[model samples]
Target: MLSMAWLASALIGAFSLAVHAEQSHPAGKVHLGASERRADVTGLRPIITWPGSRPAQLGQAPSASTTAAPAPPNFNLNELMRSILFPNANVIFNVQIVDPGEKPKGPPPDIAANFSISGWGDNLYPRWDVVSYGAVGLEESAYLLMKPDRLCQNGKPVPVKREDWIKYVAELSATAKAVYTASLARDRDAVAGLADRLNESCATCHQAYRTG
Candidate 1:
């Protein structure tokens, strides 16, 4: 009878140890059945876990508190110049070279008919609105140029951190604002007069950073 009692106690202790082992198992070390092991091996098992070991709801959006904020956009310096600064600067520069009030000699082009493309002579030139937009674009370009993560054409990061680059961008912004004010007043002479200062601002920056 004593031997039988001893055997019963030993079996109870082993059973308790087994249960404790399962409960105390570290995360991701849970024992799996053959089918579970097969599913894991085949990558058919879901791996995501929720707080307090709760199962995730199907098709449910994650809580905003848990979601990461989106990253800021990055831009290329060359593309920014070609698309924004160069085109807008041309609008200001054209006011100096071409008479904005001059009428087109020929009939309106196909671009005017179907709006297939944007042109300078009839669509952009002589229009105070377009020139104003151009100046606004130039002012905005100053901020864009200073944005972090912008890359140059050579795959190197833009030197926005440099003091000279900051000064150049500030000059561009101030020049753009002056052009915008002149454009608003419809003062062709004022816009024309500021063209030299605008050119000088751009040329100085290019000579320092862009040219070989």
Candidate 2:
């Protein structure tokens, strides 16, 4: 009876040690009664807790979102105005030059008349290429104007408020789209009317946002 009691006590002590080992190590590790030294395990090492210096928070701060904002364009708003907006708007204006009245003179004989990229003539067909080019340029410029965090050469934000700026850009896009549709339908009068609207939209934006 004494020998049996000693055996039972030893088994209980071993079971307690096994439970203690399991609790101390990370999950998935095999706890053995007797095995090689920990250092002998080829790629295994003790789990490490993060240092007290670091915080173990889950969600990031709200202000951290600003860091993810898209980067501004390489060039400034003024450069974009000069290179893209002005040039493309001029293309539309030149359409009036090429064909002024309902009955414009046919292609200039000796280049005297101001002919535009669209062409110079009283022909029935519209200059689809010229129309498309000008319309697309204006539309794309409007899109750029609406991009976030745009600035002028002097590093100033757009002169107008964000809402107003977006409104103006949308207006410009609408005018250009109307012009494109008119051109597609070969409606010279409608195209001319829309061109005037385009000019107005541009003037409005420049008045509000153009900087020194």
Candidate 3:
């Protein structure tokens, strides 16, 4: 490699000498100086160049562009509500049926069948069918929680004070909304805590009604 490099350098020097000698005008023009014999320098530049911008680094992120990027995951809000409402449906049921590392009682069904979730016959999950009225029920529960004592006012008898209802519902909604939003924002471990609020609401309702 050393000899080859030396050989290459010698060839280049010889070529440059030949070119310069050819450019000399037969030793004539005794009045012409070396600078005068040179080519025009006004528009000339170094042959090699580089970019003005720096490249992205190893393991470093590129600058974000404002182009059309792939969107965030499309989590269906309706499906999420439905899944929460009926925790025993399809995948949810299968997951709940098994303890950690424990096998389920049966083999897995086809995806087509699994997707077609059906109603449980009994109190296995009462809130399932009634989830269609979720918005109404949630609003009613919010009102009751806000004004619990108002339930028996001027009419039949019930429990709870009016003003405390507002406080209770606000507490539940705020926490649930925050955790659920974080889950939607891609926090993988948020669903369980948010789901706990739902169960807590149900337990409170059951205690209040004596049969929720």
Query: Per-residue CA lDDT of candidate 1, range 160-187, in tens?
Result: 8999999999999999999888876778
Error of 1 at 141 (Å): 0.7
CA lDDT, every prediction? 0.77, 0.66, 0.40
Residue pairs in steric clash, candidate 1? none
Judge candidate 1 at residue 74 and give its lDDT.
58
State residue 2's C-alpha deviation in candidate 1, in Å.
98
Highest lDDT among the candidates is held by which one? 1
Segments of candidate 1 deviating more than 4 angstroms: 1-72, 105-116, 119-126
The CA root-mean-square deviation of candidate 3, after full C-alpha superposition on the true structure, stands at: 31.1
Q: What TM-score would every model get versus the actual structure? A: 0.60, 0.53, 0.29
The digit string of per-residue lDDT tens for model 3 on 40-115 reads: 4534543433387555344344457734665432333233234443342222222223221233358655644443
**Worst lDDT 10-window in candidate 1:** 116-125
Off by over 4 Å in 2: 1-69, 100-126, 159-161
Deviation from native of the Cα of residue 69 in model 2, angstroms: 6.3
**TM-score preference between candidates 2 and 3, better one:** 2
Which candidate do you rate higher for lDDT, 2 or 3? 2
Candidates ranked, most accurate by TM-score first: 1, 2, 3
